[model samples]
Target: MDASLLREREAFLRRAKALPVVEKPRAVSNAVNDLGPPPTKRIASSVPSDLRSAELRPALQGKFAVLSSVVKYMKQRHLERDTHPLTVEEILEEARLHDTPQSTIRWLEEEVGLIVVTKE
Candidate 1:
């Protein structure tokens, strides 16, 4: 390397080293302190205990029984050896054969605890 280049490099390095370092401002916790406490999580009860004791209309009661029978038969036939998750579509199809109303199926699942509908 040339002596002139070496001298210039050393001078530049010395000047760079002498320069003061600037640090980024750190986030202060006091910014969040003014926001107040975090929101409390709400606990939701999925299944109500008093579902069985609830009275149903005569027509609904009959429909529920029909749906229950159909589900029981399907469980025995399709899921005898291994456990199989039943879908709403399959149940609805079977219920259609028995002339069960779509509303009745929804009622059985939502109101009555006879069937559980879970998200896939």
Candidate 2:
């Protein structure tokens, strides 16, 4: 770190510390602060919770988690069994997503770059 930058940062810290002592603390009100607590009940819900539940939407739920698991499984398999370049089917099976859709699989290939899925 540069000595000038360190001194400037120290000056900034001193200014910040001095603020509380120099000025009288007063309540700064905002809409959220005025509100005591958030409503426990769902206030605006046209969509039901069951429609958004993971049990109903297995393919969309925890996609990043699935990707991470697939990568970890692949790495572990390669380390233990000398496997290379796992197929998407193998990945899906390892992740136990037997009923994952084609579009999501295409996303794993195209958007996430897990593999290149060539058309046969």
Candidate 3:
């Protein structure tokens, strides 16, 4: 085989691999947004507790700042805890409830107090 022919074949293969054809779906407009009274549902708040439960609805909810403050306070409680040392199971359980490990640790510490911390 000619050396030049082998080189040409390799180049052709590389080109074919690089420029494979693709068929993308076209964007379809349903023509629905302008034909209705808009959505009737309200967004729910994140840190919903009994104290703020009444204010969680869209009609009564405050700004995101208030929600953020509640989250910050929750986190602070976790960090400042001197209770028991957090176990892996307890940590995982807390994480399941709040979707955050830090929040779980704080909550567990709050629940058990001195039991969760170590003496040393």
TM for every model, in the order presented, reads 0.34, 0.42, 0.23
Residue-by-residue lDDT tens digits, candidate 2, 1-120: 999999999999999988866676767778686887987875786777877575554576656656776778777887898655567877788767777878877778878988754445
Model 1 vs. true fold: TM = 0.34
Top TM-score hit: 2
lDDT of 3: 0.52
Clashing pairs in 1: none
lDDT of 3 by residue, 48-106 (tens): 58758545542243333333444455476578883444553443444333333454345
Q: How much is the lDDT of residue 78 in candidate 2?
A: 79
Q: After superposition, how far is residue 9 of candidate 1 from its true place, in Å?
A: 99
| Candidate 2 to truth, TM | 0.42
lDDT tens readout by residue for model 1, 7-59: 99999999999999999997777977877999899987565756633334223
Score candidate 1 by lDDT: 0.65
Cα RMSDs of all predictions? 14.8, 8.3, 11.8
Worst lDDT run of 10 residues, candidate 2, spans: 54-63
